[model samples]
Target: MSLFLTLKVALRALIRNKVRSILTMLGIIIGIAAVIAVVAVGQGATVMIQEQISSMGDNILMIFPGSASSGGLHFGAGTRSTLTPQDAEAIMNECLYVKAVSPMVRAGGQVIYQDKNWSTSVNGVSPSYLEVRNWELKEGAFFTDSEVKAASKVCVIGATVAKELFDTESPVEKTIRIRNMPFKIIGVLVKKGSAAFGQDQDDTIIAPWSSVSRFLQRGSFNSVNQLLVSATSIKTIELAKTDITSILRQRHKLSEGTDDDFSIIDTAEITKAITATATTMTMLLAIIASISLLVGGIGIMNIMLVSVTERTREIGLRMAVGARSKDILLQFLVEAMVLAGIGGVFGIIIGGSTAEIVARYNDWPVLVSAQSTVIAFLFSAAVGIFFGFFPAWRASRLNPIEALRYE
Candidate 1:
């Protein structure tokens, strides 16, 4: 029989048992849907992480005061009190690959705006802090170099702080008291919701580092909490790191092989680590989903075997007439593939809808790429062929006389 006739016969056979055909395709549909949904969620999560990290800065690297291990003892960030504003200035003046540097001094206090007061973090930093962090102002302007030089009590409030303290009022040109010292609110930072690790991105205030170090911080006058550094560009990140390491070590007079007093957190490295973790999770889920696809293929094979037995006399009559063995094999194979293909189509629709619903409800993202969809459909078809082959071959090899004589 011709290819068209084989397809017509196979489809007719499937239509004759619609319920059974649908039941057999269930495993495949469930498996494909699970895989697609998993992949879409994973991709969306990775993108969100990247966006959060990118919001932190352009070629950003944070310099904390101490390493995980320092002086043969455990020391976490800001514990050593080794970094100073002078060191940040040195990096800015000496490192060619460094684009911007902001020495940060952190303090916690209640900010009082009229009758309303909100407890929030206050950061002392230079005007360049916004540039290094790639943050923008929603209103007014950042403090000037003269304000930083003079340790002036001028400030920029984050979106959270503004909302809590001033509500709908634009915070610009307003005054708020921090630790009993009044600070003029010069700008309101644009809202940045949260980090990948769930830290609130905008719940603080920015002021001159000089002011924070002079009046707010309790310890050494010269020391800063951290240094926010930005490389000239992404391509120069490693070179900037090397330059920073060498300059800081020489200034601190560290010996060879000794761990440096400072710790550098590379935003790019953090991105890679997070994305790798997401990809691993996605792959594991896909593997688990594939088990259903295997079970579906097995069901198809079992059903085909039963079909061959039940239609043995029909098969015998076809062969006795003029149908070739290859024709008989193709007909059965087409039926299995068509069954699987239809399941795959349905699976794609359900998977996409599931992903969409999840994203909508959770305020998350979902990316159902075209490449993943095509691969899933093709894989289902391949599963059908591999499982259907044995039954098709068995039916094609049966002796016509024996098949005809069988009850």
Candidate 2:
């Protein structure tokens, strides 16, 4: 028989049992839908995470003061002030892979302007801080190196600080008081919503390290709280770390057996860890959903076996009338594929709509890429072929005389 006649015969057979065919496709429909929705949400979340990481910095690394052990009591990292502004300068000047460096000290107090008061963090940092953090100014210029060297009482504020203190007024050239000392605002930073840890990114102020150390900090020692560094390139991040470790160790005069008094955290490594977690979750959900598709394929095989038994005399009649076994095989296989293909199409539509509904109501991100859609459809078709083959083979092997004798 011709291919077209075979298809026509297959369709006719399925049409005779429309309800059963539809029921058999249910598992595939649900499975495909689940896979699509899960993948879409996962991809969207990954993209959002990447954006957040980029906003944090480009090729950035954070160095914190090492832990302190006193009287057998050990405190974790950032508990002791072991770093200094001079160490940051040494790294910037001597490290080959380092692109930028900023030494930082932190203080927090209520910032007051006129009658308005807002509590926020005040950070002391060098001019290179803007580059190391990939921060941008909303208005006005950053404080110059000359101002930093002079320990000038000048500062820049974050977007949250600007809104709470200045309202509609531009913060440039204004003055805000922290710790009973006034500092002129030289710039306003662009808004960054939040950090991965859920801290408000825009609720802080920036000032030169010299000015902050002199006016804000009440410490007897010249120690810094943190160091922010940017590598020359992403590929050179490890090299930058090596150079920094070597420079810091040599400057501190540490012996070969002595432990270093600092910790370095690579933001890129954190990004990879987060993205990998998302990918793993997506794959896990997809695998669970695929189980239903497998079950649906089994349903098709069981139904096709029953179909062969019901049409035993018809099979004998066709075979006796010159219908080739291959033709019989093709008809049954096509019927099975048609069922699965139609189910897959419906599944895709339902899945996409469900994702859109979730995104619209919950304000969540969901992306249904063409690659995923095509993959889901192809997998459904493959399931049909794999399950349909056994029943088709059994039908083709029927003895014509014996089948005719079957009641």
Q: How many residue pairs clash in each candidate?
A: 1, 0
lDDT of 2 by residue, 211-268 (tens): 8888998863378889999999999999999889988899888899999888899989
TM-score per candidate, in order? Answer: 0.93, 0.91
User: Considering only N, C-alpha and C atoms within 3 Å, which residue pairs clash in candidate 1?
Assistant: 125-209
What would the TM-score be for candidate 2 when compared with the true structure? Answer: 0.91
TM-score of 1: 0.93
Which ten residues in a row are the worst by lDDT in model 2? 357-366
RMSD of model 2 against the true structure: 2.4
lDDT of 1 by residue, 1-407 (tens): 77788888988999998899999888779878888888888787788888888878889989998745646788556678889888999999999999899999999898898999988999999889988998899999999999988888899999999999988988899999998889999899999888768888899999999888887888787889889999999999999999999999999999999888998888999998999998999899889888888988899999889888988998898889977898789878988888888888888888878887887787776788899999989998998899888989998998999988778
Pairs of residues clashing in candidate 2: none
